[model samples]
Target: MSIQPGEKLVFGAPSTLSDRLTHYCPGCHHGIGTRLVAEVLEEFGCIKETIGVASVGCSVFTYNYIVADWVEAAHGRACATATGVKRARPDRMVFTYQGDGDLAAIGFNESVQAANRGEHITVIFVNNTIYGMTGGQMAPTSLIGQKTTTSPRGRNPKKEGAPLRMAELLAPLDGVAFSARCAMDSVAHVNAAKRAIRKAFDVQRQNLGFGFVELLSGCPTNLHMDPLSANRRVREEMIPYFPLGVFKDVTANEKAGA
Candidate 1:
Protein backbone atom coordinates (compact mmCIF):
# COMPACT_ATOMS: atom_id res chain seq x y z
CA MET A 1 0.00 0.00 0.00
CA SER A 2 2.00 2.95 -1.29
CA ILE A 3 0.70 6.49 -1.20
CA GLN A 4 0.68 8.53 -4.39
CA PRO A 5 2.66 11.80 -4.48
CA GLY A 6 -0.42 13.93 -3.95
CA GLU A 7 -2.54 11.46 -1.97
CA LYS A 8 -3.21 12.52 1.60
CA LEU A 9 -4.04 10.65 4.74
CA VAL A 10 -7.38 11.89 6.01
CA PHE A 11 -7.72 9.67 9.09
CA GLY A 12 -5.41 8.30 11.76
CA ALA A 13 -5.34 7.55 15.47
CA PRO A 14 -5.29 10.55 17.79
CA SER A 15 -2.21 11.25 19.88
CA THR A 16 -4.33 11.35 23.01
CA LEU A 17 -5.46 7.73 22.50
CA SER A 18 -3.45 4.63 23.25
CA ASP A 19 -2.15 2.60 20.30
CA ARG A 20 -2.77 -0.76 21.94
CA LEU A 21 -5.56 -3.12 20.96
CA THR A 22 -8.85 -2.96 22.87
CA HIS A 23 -10.26 -5.87 24.87
CA TYR A 24 -13.86 -5.17 23.97
CA CYS A 25 -15.64 -8.00 22.14
CA PRO A 26 -16.05 -7.90 18.37
CA GLY A 27 -18.96 -5.72 17.23
CA CYS A 28 -18.92 -3.77 20.49
CA HIS A 29 -19.22 0.00 20.05
CA HIS A 30 -17.10 0.85 23.10
CA GLY A 31 -14.02 1.26 20.97
CA ILE A 32 -15.70 3.63 18.55
CA GLY A 33 -17.22 5.66 21.37
CA THR A 34 -13.91 6.01 23.21
CA ARG A 35 -12.11 6.90 20.00
CA LEU A 36 -14.52 9.73 19.39
CA VAL A 37 -13.95 10.99 22.92
CA ALA A 38 -10.17 10.99 22.52
CA GLU A 39 -10.46 12.75 19.17
CA VAL A 40 -12.62 15.49 20.68
CA LEU A 41 -10.23 16.04 23.58
CA GLU A 42 -7.31 16.22 21.19
CA GLU A 43 -9.13 18.66 18.91
CA PHE A 44 -9.74 20.92 21.90
CA GLY A 45 -6.06 20.64 22.98
CA CYS A 46 -7.02 19.68 26.54
CA ILE A 47 -5.85 16.07 26.78
CA LYS A 48 -3.11 16.87 29.29
CA GLU A 49 -5.48 18.83 31.52
CA THR A 50 -8.19 16.20 31.31
CA ILE A 51 -9.22 13.93 34.17
CA GLY A 52 -11.44 10.93 33.56
CA VAL A 53 -13.65 8.94 35.93
CA ALA A 54 -14.45 5.36 35.01
CA SER A 55 -17.11 3.31 36.78
CA VAL A 56 -17.55 -0.47 37.04
CA GLY A 57 -18.65 -2.38 33.93
CA CYS A 58 -17.14 -2.67 30.46
CA SER A 59 -16.47 1.07 30.52
CA VAL A 60 -14.16 0.59 33.48
CA PHE A 61 -11.29 0.05 31.07
CA THR A 62 -11.72 3.39 29.36
CA TYR A 63 -8.52 4.65 30.93
CA ASN A 64 -6.63 1.83 29.24
CA TYR A 65 -7.56 3.02 25.78
CA ILE A 66 -7.37 6.77 26.34
CA VAL A 67 -4.27 8.55 27.66
CA ALA A 68 -5.45 10.73 30.51
CA ASP A 69 -5.40 11.07 34.27
CA TRP A 70 -8.08 8.63 35.40
CA VAL A 71 -9.78 7.55 38.62
CA GLU A 72 -11.67 4.33 39.09
CA ALA A 73 -15.00 4.90 40.80
CA ALA A 74 -17.16 2.47 42.70
CA HIS A 75 -20.06 0.86 40.91
CA GLY A 76 -22.61 3.52 39.98
CA ARG A 77 -20.54 6.29 41.55
CA ALA A 78 -18.83 7.84 38.51
CA CYS A 79 -20.80 11.08 38.69
CA ALA A 80 -20.01 11.48 42.38
CA THR A 81 -16.35 10.83 41.70
CA ALA A 82 -16.23 13.22 38.73
CA THR A 83 -17.87 15.98 40.75
CA GLY A 84 -15.22 15.67 43.42
CA VAL A 85 -12.45 15.71 40.83
CA LYS A 86 -13.84 18.82 39.12
CA ARG A 87 -14.45 20.75 42.33
CA ALA A 88 -10.99 20.00 43.66
CA ARG A 89 -9.28 21.05 40.42
CA PRO A 90 -11.39 23.41 38.40
CA ASP A 91 -8.63 23.94 35.87
CA ARG A 92 -8.75 20.38 34.65
CA MET A 93 -11.40 19.04 32.29
CA VAL A 94 -13.27 16.22 34.04
CA PHE A 95 -15.51 13.57 32.54
CA THR A 96 -16.97 10.14 33.17
CA TYR A 97 -17.56 7.27 30.75
CA GLN A 98 -20.21 4.88 32.02
CA GLY A 99 -22.36 2.01 30.86
CA ASP A 100 -26.11 1.96 31.19
CA GLY A 101 -26.04 -0.47 34.11
CA ASP A 102 -23.53 1.64 35.99
CA LEU A 103 -25.34 4.90 35.21
CA ALA A 104 -29.07 4.35 34.78
CA ALA A 105 -29.28 1.65 37.43
CA ILE A 106 -27.70 2.08 40.84
CA GLY A 107 -25.90 5.33 39.98
CA PHE A 108 -28.91 7.24 38.65
CA ASN A 109 -29.40 9.11 41.90
CA GLU A 110 -25.81 10.26 42.12
CA SER A 111 -25.83 11.37 38.48
CA VAL A 112 -29.05 13.28 38.91
CA GLN A 113 -27.88 15.01 42.07
CA ALA A 114 -24.66 16.04 40.39
CA ALA A 115 -26.50 17.45 37.40
CA ASN A 116 -29.12 19.15 39.56
CA ARG A 117 -26.29 20.84 41.46
CA GLY A 118 -24.85 22.10 38.19
CA GLU A 119 -21.57 20.33 38.63
CA HIS A 120 -19.09 21.30 35.95
CA ILE A 121 -18.54 17.82 34.49
CA THR A 122 -19.34 15.77 31.43
CA VAL A 123 -20.96 12.34 31.32
CA ILE A 124 -20.60 9.97 28.35
CA PHE A 125 -23.24 7.30 28.75
CA VAL A 126 -23.22 4.22 26.53
CA ASN A 127 -26.64 2.64 26.41
CA ASN A 128 -26.49 -0.80 24.81
CA THR A 129 -29.80 -1.60 26.49
CA ILE A 130 -28.59 -4.83 28.13
CA TYR A 131 -25.89 -5.12 30.78
CA GLY A 132 -22.85 -6.19 28.78
CA MET A 133 -20.26 -7.04 31.40
CA THR A 134 -22.46 -8.91 33.86
CA GLY A 135 -23.73 -11.71 31.64
CA GLY A 136 -26.32 -9.68 29.76
CA GLN A 137 -28.69 -8.89 32.57
CA MET A 138 -31.60 -6.54 32.03
CA ALA A 139 -30.44 -2.97 32.64
CA PRO A 140 -32.53 0.02 33.69
CA THR A 141 -32.56 1.21 30.09
CA SER A 142 -33.50 -2.12 28.55
CA LEU A 143 -36.28 -1.78 26.04
CA ILE A 144 -39.73 -3.30 26.38
CA GLY A 145 -39.96 -6.93 25.15
CA GLN A 146 -36.19 -7.20 25.32
CA LYS A 147 -35.00 -10.54 26.69
CA THR A 148 -32.09 -10.84 29.04
CA THR A 149 -30.73 -13.25 31.63
CA THR A 150 -32.69 -11.49 34.36
CA SER A 151 -35.75 -11.21 32.18
CA PRO A 152 -35.86 -14.50 30.35
CA ARG A 153 -39.43 -13.92 29.29
CA GLY A 154 -38.80 -10.42 28.00
CA ARG A 155 -39.19 -7.03 29.72
CA ASN A 156 -42.75 -6.22 30.75
CA PRO A 157 -43.72 -2.59 31.25
CA LYS A 158 -46.28 -3.40 33.94
CA LYS A 159 -43.85 -5.43 36.04
CA GLU A 160 -40.51 -3.75 35.29
CA GLY A 161 -41.83 -0.30 34.35
CA ALA A 162 -40.59 1.59 31.27
CA PRO A 163 -37.05 2.14 30.05
CA LEU A 164 -35.39 5.23 31.45
CA ARG A 165 -34.51 7.88 28.86
CA MET A 166 -31.58 9.55 30.57
CA ALA A 167 -31.06 12.29 27.99
CA GLU A 168 -34.69 13.37 28.04
CA LEU A 169 -34.93 12.93 31.80
CA LEU A 170 -31.88 15.04 32.59
CA ALA A 171 -32.42 17.68 29.90
CA PRO A 172 -35.23 19.35 31.85
CA LEU A 173 -33.04 19.85 34.92
CA ASP A 174 -32.02 23.47 35.44
CA GLY A 175 -28.44 22.52 36.20
CA VAL A 176 -27.87 20.71 32.95
CA ALA A 177 -26.25 22.86 30.29
CA PHE A 178 -26.54 20.20 27.58
CA SER A 179 -28.26 16.85 27.13
CA ALA A 180 -28.40 14.85 23.91
CA ARG A 181 -28.75 11.33 22.48
CA CYS A 182 -27.00 9.83 19.45
CA ALA A 183 -26.70 6.44 17.81
CA MET A 184 -23.68 4.49 16.50
CA ASP A 185 -25.36 2.53 13.75
CA SER A 186 -24.34 4.40 10.61
CA VAL A 187 -21.59 6.68 9.36
CA ALA A 188 -23.86 9.74 9.51
CA HIS A 189 -25.04 8.85 12.99
CA VAL A 190 -21.50 8.25 14.18
CA ASN A 191 -20.48 11.68 12.91
CA ALA A 192 -23.49 13.16 14.65
CA ALA A 193 -22.53 11.33 17.83
CA LYS A 194 -19.07 12.83 17.66
CA ARG A 195 -20.51 16.31 17.28
CA ALA A 196 -22.80 15.74 20.25
CA ILE A 197 -19.88 14.54 22.35
CA ARG A 198 -17.85 17.60 21.35
CA LYS A 199 -20.68 19.88 22.39
CA ALA A 200 -21.00 18.14 25.75
CA PHE A 201 -17.33 18.78 26.37
CA ASP A 202 -17.62 22.36 25.15
CA VAL A 203 -20.35 23.03 27.67
CA GLN A 204 -18.10 21.78 30.47
CA ARG A 205 -15.07 23.72 29.23
CA GLN A 206 -17.11 26.93 29.34
CA ASN A 207 -17.80 26.37 33.05
CA LEU A 208 -21.49 26.50 32.28
CA GLY A 209 -23.02 23.44 33.98
CA PHE A 210 -23.34 19.69 33.86
CA GLY A 211 -23.22 18.11 30.37
CA PHE A 212 -24.50 14.71 29.32
CA VAL A 213 -24.52 12.68 26.10
CA GLU A 214 -26.20 9.33 25.68
CA LEU A 215 -24.81 7.11 22.93
CA LEU A 216 -27.04 4.31 21.72
CA SER A 217 -24.58 1.52 21.07
CA GLY A 218 -24.67 -2.12 20.08
CA CYS A 219 -23.68 -5.19 22.14
CA PRO A 220 -23.59 -8.08 19.71
CA THR A 221 -22.50 -10.66 22.24
CA ASN A 222 -25.18 -9.70 24.75
CA LEU A 223 -27.82 -9.32 22.08
CA HIS A 224 -26.82 -12.72 20.61
CA MET A 225 -26.60 -11.32 17.13
CA ASP A 226 -23.97 -10.73 14.51
CA PRO A 227 -22.27 -7.35 14.20
CA LEU A 228 -24.43 -6.23 11.33
CA SER A 229 -27.61 -7.43 13.00
CA ALA A 230 -26.80 -5.71 16.27
CA ASN A 231 -26.15 -2.46 14.40
CA ARG A 232 -29.48 -2.84 12.67
CA ARG A 233 -31.16 -3.18 16.04
CA VAL A 234 -29.69 0.12 17.13
CA ARG A 235 -30.81 1.85 13.94
CA GLU A 236 -34.24 0.24 13.81
CA GLU A 237 -35.43 -0.52 17.32
CA MET A 238 -33.37 1.65 19.64
CA ILE A 239 -33.46 4.83 17.58
CA PRO A 240 -37.21 4.68 17.20
CA TYR A 241 -37.77 4.38 20.93
CA PHE A 242 -35.02 6.67 22.19
CA PRO A 243 -34.89 9.12 19.26
CA LEU A 244 -31.61 10.84 18.35
CA GLY A 245 -31.20 14.61 18.88
CA VAL A 246 -30.39 17.22 21.46
CA PHE A 247 -33.00 17.43 24.19
CA LYS A 248 -31.44 20.51 25.74
CA ASP A 249 -28.57 22.85 24.94
CA VAL A 250 -28.06 26.09 26.85
CA THR A 251 -25.24 27.06 24.53
CA ALA A 252 -27.78 27.51 21.76
CA ASN A 253 -29.00 30.71 23.35
CA GLU A 254 -25.46 31.96 23.84
CA LYS A 255 -24.59 31.27 20.22
CA ALA A 256 -27.82 32.89 19.13
CA GLY A 257 -26.95 36.01 21.09
CA ALA A 258 -23.51 36.08 19.52
Candidate 2:
Protein backbone atom coordinates (compact mmCIF):
# COMPACT_ATOMS: atom_id res chain seq x y z
CA MET A 1 0.00 0.00 0.00
CA SER A 2 2.91 2.29 0.69
CA ILE A 3 4.33 2.01 -2.83
CA GLN A 4 2.38 4.25 -5.12
CA PRO A 5 1.31 3.27 -8.64
CA GLY A 6 4.64 4.23 -10.19
CA GLU A 7 6.77 4.58 -7.12
CA LYS A 8 9.30 2.00 -8.32
CA LEU A 9 8.79 2.69 -12.00
CA VAL A 10 11.47 4.04 -14.31
CA PHE A 11 9.91 7.50 -14.24
CA GLY A 12 8.41 9.15 -11.20
CA ALA A 13 6.57 12.37 -10.73
CA PRO A 14 8.41 15.50 -11.82
CA SER A 15 9.94 17.16 -8.74
CA THR A 16 8.71 20.52 -10.00
CA LEU A 17 5.16 19.32 -9.42
CA SER A 18 4.21 19.15 -5.79
CA ASP A 19 2.94 16.05 -4.03
CA ARG A 20 -0.31 17.74 -3.10
CA LEU A 21 -3.48 16.28 -4.57
CA THR A 22 -4.69 18.35 -7.50
CA HIS A 23 -8.07 20.03 -7.31
CA TYR A 24 -9.06 18.94 -10.79
CA CYS A 25 -12.05 16.73 -11.50
CA PRO A 26 -11.47 13.17 -12.55
CA GLY A 27 -10.44 12.96 -16.25
CA CYS A 28 -9.79 16.65 -16.48
CA HIS A 29 -6.71 17.35 -18.63
CA HIS A 30 -5.55 20.30 -16.59
CA GLY A 31 -3.45 17.90 -14.57
CA ILE A 32 -1.75 16.73 -17.75
CA GLY A 33 -1.02 20.30 -18.81
CA THR A 34 0.39 21.15 -15.39
CA ARG A 35 2.50 18.01 -15.25
CA LEU A 36 3.91 18.68 -18.71
CA VAL A 37 4.81 22.23 -17.76
CA ALA A 38 6.49 21.00 -14.60
CA GLU A 39 8.45 18.41 -16.53
CA VAL A 40 9.55 21.03 -19.06
CA LEU A 41 10.69 23.33 -16.31
CA GLU A 42 12.57 20.49 -14.73
CA GLU A 43 14.22 19.55 -18.03
CA PHE A 44 15.30 23.15 -18.49
CA GLY A 45 16.53 23.40 -14.87
CA CYS A 46 14.50 26.57 -14.41
CA ILE A 47 12.08 25.42 -11.72
CA LYS A 48 13.64 27.82 -9.30
CA GLU A 49 14.28 30.68 -11.69
CA THR A 50 10.89 30.46 -13.36
CA ILE A 51 8.27 32.96 -12.28
CA GLY A 52 4.73 31.77 -12.94
CA VAL A 53 1.99 34.31 -13.43
CA ALA A 54 -1.13 32.43 -12.40
CA SER A 55 -4.29 33.60 -14.13
CA VAL A 56 -7.67 33.69 -12.47
CA GLY A 57 -9.86 30.57 -12.89
CA CYS A 58 -9.18 27.00 -11.88
CA SER A 59 -5.73 27.45 -13.43
CA VAL A 60 -4.75 29.93 -10.75
CA PHE A 61 -4.05 27.09 -8.34
CA THR A 62 -0.90 26.45 -10.37
CA TYR A 63 1.01 28.28 -7.64
CA ASN A 64 0.33 25.47 -5.20
CA TYR A 65 0.75 22.69 -7.74
CA ILE A 66 4.02 23.74 -9.40
CA VAL A 67 7.18 24.30 -7.41
CA ALA A 68 7.96 27.78 -8.68
CA ASP A 69 7.79 31.39 -7.68
CA TRP A 70 4.30 32.52 -8.69
CA VAL A 71 2.25 35.69 -8.64
CA GLU A 72 -1.51 35.57 -8.79
CA ALA A 73 -2.87 37.91 -11.40
CA ALA A 74 -6.18 39.64 -11.83
CA HIS A 75 -8.79 37.92 -14.00
CA GLY A 76 -7.68 37.89 -17.65
CA ARG A 77 -4.42 39.72 -16.85
CA ALA A 78 -1.94 36.87 -16.79
CA CYS A 79 -0.06 37.99 -19.89
CA ALA A 80 0.15 41.54 -18.57
CA THR A 81 1.50 40.27 -15.27
CA ALA A 82 4.01 38.01 -16.98
CA THR A 83 5.18 40.92 -19.11
CA GLY A 84 5.92 43.06 -16.09
CA VAL A 85 7.69 40.20 -14.33
CA LYS A 86 9.79 39.37 -17.37
CA ARG A 87 10.75 43.01 -17.85
CA ALA A 88 11.71 43.52 -14.22
CA ARG A 89 13.23 40.13 -13.61
CA PRO A 90 15.05 39.62 -16.84
CA ASP A 91 17.33 37.12 -15.18
CA ARG A 92 14.44 34.76 -14.45
CA MET A 93 12.14 32.77 -16.69
CA VAL A 94 8.58 34.11 -16.78
CA PHE A 95 5.47 32.21 -17.87
CA THR A 96 1.72 32.41 -17.53
CA TYR A 97 -0.90 29.67 -17.12
CA GLN A 98 -4.19 30.82 -18.58
CA GLY A 99 -7.54 29.39 -19.67
CA ASP A 100 -9.65 29.94 -22.78
CA GLY A 101 -11.87 32.36 -20.92
CA ASP A 102 -8.92 34.27 -19.57
CA LEU A 103 -6.73 34.27 -22.66
CA ALA A 104 -9.23 34.41 -25.52
CA ALA A 105 -11.95 36.47 -23.93
CA ILE A 106 -11.31 39.12 -21.31
CA GLY A 107 -7.53 39.04 -21.70
CA PHE A 108 -7.38 38.96 -25.48
CA ASN A 109 -6.11 42.51 -25.80
CA GLU A 110 -3.42 42.06 -23.17
CA SER A 111 -2.29 38.77 -24.64
CA VAL A 112 -2.09 40.29 -28.15
CA GLN A 113 -0.29 43.42 -26.97
CA ALA A 114 2.31 41.45 -25.01
CA ALA A 115 2.94 39.12 -27.94
CA ASN A 116 3.15 42.05 -30.32
CA ARG A 117 5.77 43.72 -28.14
CA GLY A 118 7.74 40.47 -28.12
CA GLU A 119 7.65 40.03 -24.39
CA HIS A 120 10.22 37.47 -23.33
CA ILE A 121 7.79 35.09 -21.62
CA THR A 122 5.85 31.89 -22.13
CA VAL A 123 2.09 31.31 -22.18
CA ILE A 124 0.61 27.94 -21.18
CA PHE A 125 -3.01 28.23 -22.29
CA VAL A 126 -5.58 25.56 -21.41
CA ASN A 127 -8.56 25.76 -23.75
CA ASN A 128 -11.31 23.32 -22.76
CA THR A 129 -13.94 25.26 -24.77
CA ILE A 130 -15.88 26.20 -21.65
CA TYR A 131 -15.18 28.01 -18.43
CA GLY A 132 -14.28 24.95 -16.43
CA MET A 133 -14.21 26.44 -12.96
CA THR A 134 -16.52 29.40 -13.37
CA GLY A 135 -19.75 27.43 -13.70
CA GLY A 136 -19.08 26.20 -17.25
CA GLN A 137 -19.88 29.33 -19.16
CA MET A 138 -19.33 29.47 -22.90
CA ALA A 139 -15.82 30.73 -23.61
CA PRO A 140 -14.58 32.61 -26.63
CA THR A 141 -12.81 29.44 -27.73
CA SER A 142 -15.95 27.34 -27.40
CA LEU A 143 -16.84 25.76 -30.72
CA ILE A 144 -20.05 26.47 -32.58
CA GLY A 145 -22.93 24.47 -31.11
CA GLN A 146 -20.94 23.53 -28.04
CA LYS A 147 -23.33 23.66 -25.16
CA THR A 148 -22.41 25.33 -21.90
CA THR A 149 -24.12 26.92 -18.92
CA THR A 150 -24.52 30.10 -20.92
CA SER A 151 -25.21 28.27 -24.18
CA PRO A 152 -27.47 25.45 -23.03
CA ARG A 153 -29.32 25.33 -26.33
CA GLY A 154 -25.96 24.78 -28.01
CA ARG A 155 -23.95 27.77 -29.13
CA ASN A 156 -25.54 29.83 -31.89
CA PRO A 157 -22.67 30.88 -34.12
CA LYS A 158 -24.95 33.42 -35.80
CA LYS A 159 -25.15 35.17 -32.44
CA GLU A 160 -22.23 33.88 -30.31
CA GLY A 161 -19.76 33.56 -33.21
CA ALA A 162 -17.40 30.75 -34.09
CA PRO A 163 -14.62 29.61 -31.79
CA LEU A 164 -11.34 31.49 -31.74
CA ARG A 165 -8.22 29.73 -32.90
CA MET A 166 -5.75 31.40 -30.58
CA ALA A 167 -2.68 29.48 -31.68
CA GLU A 168 -3.34 30.29 -35.32
CA LEU A 169 -4.09 33.89 -34.45
CA LEU A 170 -0.93 34.34 -32.41
CA ALA A 171 1.44 32.60 -34.82
CA PRO A 172 1.36 35.44 -37.35
CA LEU A 173 2.67 37.98 -34.89
CA ASP A 174 6.25 39.04 -35.66
CA GLY A 175 7.08 39.08 -31.98
CA VAL A 176 5.86 35.56 -31.38
CA ALA A 177 8.79 33.17 -31.67
CA PHE A 178 6.75 30.02 -31.02
CA SER A 179 3.03 29.19 -31.12
CA ALA A 180 1.47 25.78 -31.02
CA ARG A 181 -1.81 23.97 -30.31
CA CYS A 182 -1.80 20.52 -28.76
CA ALA A 183 -4.34 18.08 -27.33
CA MET A 184 -4.24 15.67 -24.35
CA ASP A 185 -6.77 12.96 -25.06
CA SER A 186 -4.24 10.23 -25.85
CA VAL A 187 -0.68 9.27 -25.10
CA ALA A 188 0.62 10.43 -28.49
CA HIS A 189 -1.09 13.78 -28.15
CA VAL A 190 0.10 14.09 -24.54
CA ASN A 191 3.66 13.42 -25.68
CA ALA A 192 3.29 16.07 -28.37
CA ALA A 193 1.99 18.42 -25.73
CA LYS A 194 5.15 17.88 -23.72
CA ARG A 195 7.33 18.66 -26.71
CA ALA A 196 5.35 21.82 -27.38
CA ILE A 197 5.61 22.87 -23.74
CA ARG A 198 9.33 22.32 -23.71
CA LYS A 199 9.77 24.32 -26.91
CA ALA A 200 7.68 27.16 -25.51
CA PHE A 201 9.93 27.45 -22.49
CA ASP A 202 13.02 27.04 -24.63
CA VAL A 203 11.91 30.01 -26.69
CA GLN A 204 12.21 32.26 -23.67
CA ARG A 205 15.31 30.48 -22.36
CA GLN A 206 16.97 31.25 -25.67
CA ASN A 207 15.73 34.83 -25.57
CA LEU A 208 13.91 34.29 -28.85
CA GLY A 209 10.64 36.13 -28.06
CA PHE A 210 7.17 35.52 -26.77
CA GLY A 211 6.28 31.82 -26.75
CA PHE A 212 2.74 30.44 -26.53
CA VAL A 213 1.17 26.98 -26.58
CA GLU A 214 -2.55 26.37 -26.31
CA LEU A 215 -3.48 22.97 -24.89
CA LEU A 216 -6.90 21.62 -25.84
CA SER A 217 -7.83 19.94 -22.59
CA GLY A 218 -10.94 18.22 -21.26
CA CYS A 219 -13.46 19.44 -18.70
CA PRO A 220 -15.33 16.28 -17.93
CA THR A 221 -17.30 17.69 -15.04
CA ASN A 222 -18.35 20.77 -16.93
CA LEU A 223 -19.26 18.79 -20.03
CA HIS A 224 -21.40 16.36 -18.00
CA MET A 225 -19.51 13.33 -19.26
CA ASP A 226 -17.54 10.58 -17.62
CA PRO A 227 -13.77 10.43 -18.07
CA LEU A 228 -13.85 8.12 -21.04
CA SER A 229 -16.67 9.96 -22.78
CA ALA A 230 -14.93 13.30 -22.26
CA ASN A 231 -11.77 11.95 -23.84
CA ARG A 232 -13.78 10.56 -26.71
CA ARG A 233 -15.40 13.93 -27.18
CA VAL A 234 -11.97 15.47 -27.42
CA ARG A 235 -10.83 12.88 -29.96
CA GLU A 236 -13.95 13.22 -32.08
CA GLU A 237 -15.73 16.54 -31.86
CA MET A 238 -13.14 18.89 -30.34
CA ILE A 239 -10.18 17.74 -32.41
CA PRO A 240 -12.17 18.32 -35.57
CA TYR A 241 -13.09 21.83 -34.51
CA PHE A 242 -9.72 22.72 -33.00
CA PRO A 243 -7.02 20.87 -34.84
CA LEU A 244 -3.65 20.37 -33.19
CA GLY A 245 -0.09 21.12 -34.38
CA VAL A 246 2.63 23.66 -34.10
CA PHE A 247 1.44 26.79 -35.85
CA LYS A 248 4.84 28.49 -35.66
CA ASP A 249 8.32 27.81 -34.40
CA VAL A 250 10.88 30.40 -35.46
CA THR A 251 13.53 28.73 -33.35
CA ALA A 252 13.12 25.51 -35.25
CA ASN A 253 13.24 27.31 -38.58
CA GLU A 254 16.41 29.12 -37.59
CA LYS A 255 18.04 25.88 -36.53
CA ALA A 256 16.99 24.26 -39.77
CA GLY A 257 18.41 27.16 -41.73
CA ALA A 258 21.66 26.95 -39.84
Question: Highest lDDT: which candidate?
Answer: 1
For model 2, residues 1-258, the per-residue Cα lDDT tens digits are 246775676668988988899998999999999999999998888788989999998888989999999999999999999998999999999999999999989999999999999999999999999998888999998888888889989999899888999999999999999999999999999999999999998889889999999998889899999999999988898888888999899977988999
Sliding window of 10 residues with minimal summed lDDT for model 1: 1-10
In candidate 2 the C-alpha lDDT for residue 143 amounts to 80
Backbone N/Cα/C clashes per model: 0, 0
lDDT of 1 by residue, 1-258 (tens): 357899997877899998788989999999899999999999999999999999999988989989999999999999999999999999999999999999999999999999999999999999999899988999989999999999999999999999999999999899999999998888999999999999999999899999999999999999999999999999889999999999999989778989
Q: What is the lDDT of residue 234 in candidate 1?
A: 96
lDDT values for all models = 0.94, 0.91
Where model 1 places Cα greater than 4 Å from the true spot, the runs are 1-8, 256-258
Candidate 1 lands at a TM-score of 0.96
